[model samples]
Target: MTCVRPRRAARRTSRSANDSTALQALARAGYVASGVLHLLLGWLAVRLAFGSSGGNADQQGALRELADAPGGALLLWLTAVGFAGLALWQLTEAVAGVPGTDKAKQVGARAKAAAKAVLYGVLAGTAVRVATGSSGGGSEEGLTADLMRAPAGRWLVAVVGLVIVGVGVFHVVKGWRKSFRDDLRATGGGGVGQAVVRLGQVGYMAKGIALGVLGGLFVAAAVTADPEKAGGLDDALRTIREQPFGVVLLVATGLGIAAYGVYSFARARYARL
Candidate 1:
């Protein structure tokens, strides 16, 4: 009994350390890193809208841009650490669930936290790869091509497309309903808060549209048995550029994305960490 007591006490101490203020600060910084990434992507898209296609406007592109900045590698390392911390924090949330919730709500909260952990974990891995002078792997199209070559690959691709679309819809709903406010600690009331809300709404809507278009492309690729048709965010944006008044649309979307980035910064500041 004495041994068991000591062991339990040690575990409690470790848990408390993990939940330390420093770790929370690092997690918040991870949000900032994410915000910066979105800002870069938005800027790249804006440039593309203006017919300046100098680079790819995706995660890799954002990392590459970061690499070119002063102390870029160091920043990447810090970002990696921050994201990893966030992943760990989310994982803990997933395991613990939300307090005072019913079983179903608790399950839902845990699932959402698990999803966030995976997302942050991927970003952390990408940041590490960037820091190590390694190029990120193949395009989304290449992955789709590989999958389409397998048995029932087309069906799998379609399912994936549907999932993406669903995620896009969720983002739209969250933004429109301002459900994200629940995660925030304090949103300054009055003009500032209203402006922040507008940015989030616009940003989320733009992201949803982009994701919806990307999913549609994937579905088209599956239907046609042409993996080439499936692409990522950059491809989706390009497809938008091909539409009537596409330039205007793309510019608006780019601005919306930038607004989302701004909203992310606000999240970093007010998030209920």
Candidate 2:
């Protein structure tokens, strides 16, 4: 049947994508690119903690930082390609469930892979835009404005906020439980191995806290119908700076993010791919 042939071809393409060595390499590179972005974001957060208002402190800010550096354009292009490959890999995983897993686990794994695919796809698009010298898109406020303009948009925004909050909490739980280790090939060797575990815990917690704040802001925006309340990661950090003992807290958070960056590098090497 016509439908059967198409299905078979789709399966074949999925198999090819799953087994591609070049794609595996690129996915690793995507992790490295992620590391670079997180490190920059952490540094920017620390600077913000110190009352320095030099950078944006989010994904876009990280890209801008890279763009300002020497040979940044080439690096950005490579990073975009890497993230695209990662997105493709995850997409394949989402379409074709992992082999030899129980049904429940397979469902969970596929859903997670689908989420990762979306995340990497967005990053790839952003990187490409930055590399192309395009500007003025992807601002948190801008996104909020657009979202709120739709019918039942306030409710929609609220649901999105809730999902983000849920995701943040999931990250916290995952870090606390050390479940991320399941994704790795090996923890590490000796002290380095132990260090990776610690880094992952701290890093996940830090990012989770930040995401929690960001999600809270979105919920606030929805409730107040004020787009200004919703913001990106840099805005989240800036908000943290306004809290009691925020200076020290923000510094700690920055260090934790940097730790995550380092752990990401280890992941680039040890991830199950």
Candidate 3:
């Protein structure tokens, strides 16, 4: 009886250790993949905002060419898969309770659920719409122009900006209140890597605020979108330049976004798992 009890205890300990290792690996992999995806998307956004493409035929051609890349498609799919996996892992961790910390698991689970709910809701809605064949299905050309020309287009943009700002603030508060700070302070942590993590959080919050501001401006400018002005990069740049102190703010925001992308890319390349 004594011998059997000892063997059972050993088996349980080994199993627990293996589970911990697996969960940590999954979490790290998720972090790296998500960071890379964000960096890629951020770079694309900043480029489109500042580039000379201006929504012309040439620009459209370039975009199509890039979109055709197999690597880009793979990355897109991988990111979606990674996000789903991460969300599931988080939920599991929360339910089973993460080793070494219960609070961390709870906070992570809540965030994961929120993120999954939003992403899944949108994706599911899109899938339903496509399956139902609701649209007449024409080329999406001029959609941007049409929207920008709408009476409340600028206002719509501003509302989106405010929403982004709200999200950023939420993240900032969550990070400060959660176990992230303690995680950052652990022995294997700190130094440039920790700084980078902090920077990513800061950048995320900044991005939300920037988006809110940009959306508001666009909404305000809906009335002024000249037929010649259109909804191209040229018009966007021109509008920014014409607004009172808008250009400086826009430029700074653009750089902030670029920095976030660079940081994410660096994290993907060098971070553990």
lDDT-based ranking, best first?
Answer: 2, 1, 3
Tell me the deviation in Å of residue 247 in model 1: 1.1
Q: Residue-wise lDDT of candidate 2 within 153-220, one digit each (tens)?
A: 99999999999899999889988999889879998689989999999999998988899988999999
Q: What tens digits encode model 1's per-residue C-alpha lDDT throughout 1-273?
A: 989888677556545644678877877888888878888888888888889877787777777788889999988888788789888777766665544458878888878888998999998998888889887688898999999999999999999998888888988898889887787887899999988888888888888888888898899999999999999888999998999999899888888888888998898889886
Q: Model 1 compared with the native: what TM-score? A: 0.89
TM-score to true structure, per model? 0.89, 0.94, 0.49
Clashing pairs in 3: 154-218, 154-219, 155-219, 157-215, 158-215, 158-216, 161-212
- Candidate 3 lDDT by residue in tens digits, 1-273: 999888677546544643665644544555555455344334444454454443322122222333456765454344445544445455443334444556746666556545654553333232233334343332322553565457776555445445544655665464444333333333234586666665655655545544444344444444455323333332343444455776465455445554555555454345432
Model 2 regions more than 4 Å off: 1-5, 136-138
Look at candidate 2 and tell me the lDDT of residue 197.
Answer: 97
CA lDDT, every prediction? Answer: 0.84, 0.88, 0.46
Better of 1 and 2 by TM-score: 2
Worst 10 residues of 1 by lDDT: 10-19
The positional error of residue 165 in candidate 2, measured at the CA in angstroms, is: 0.7
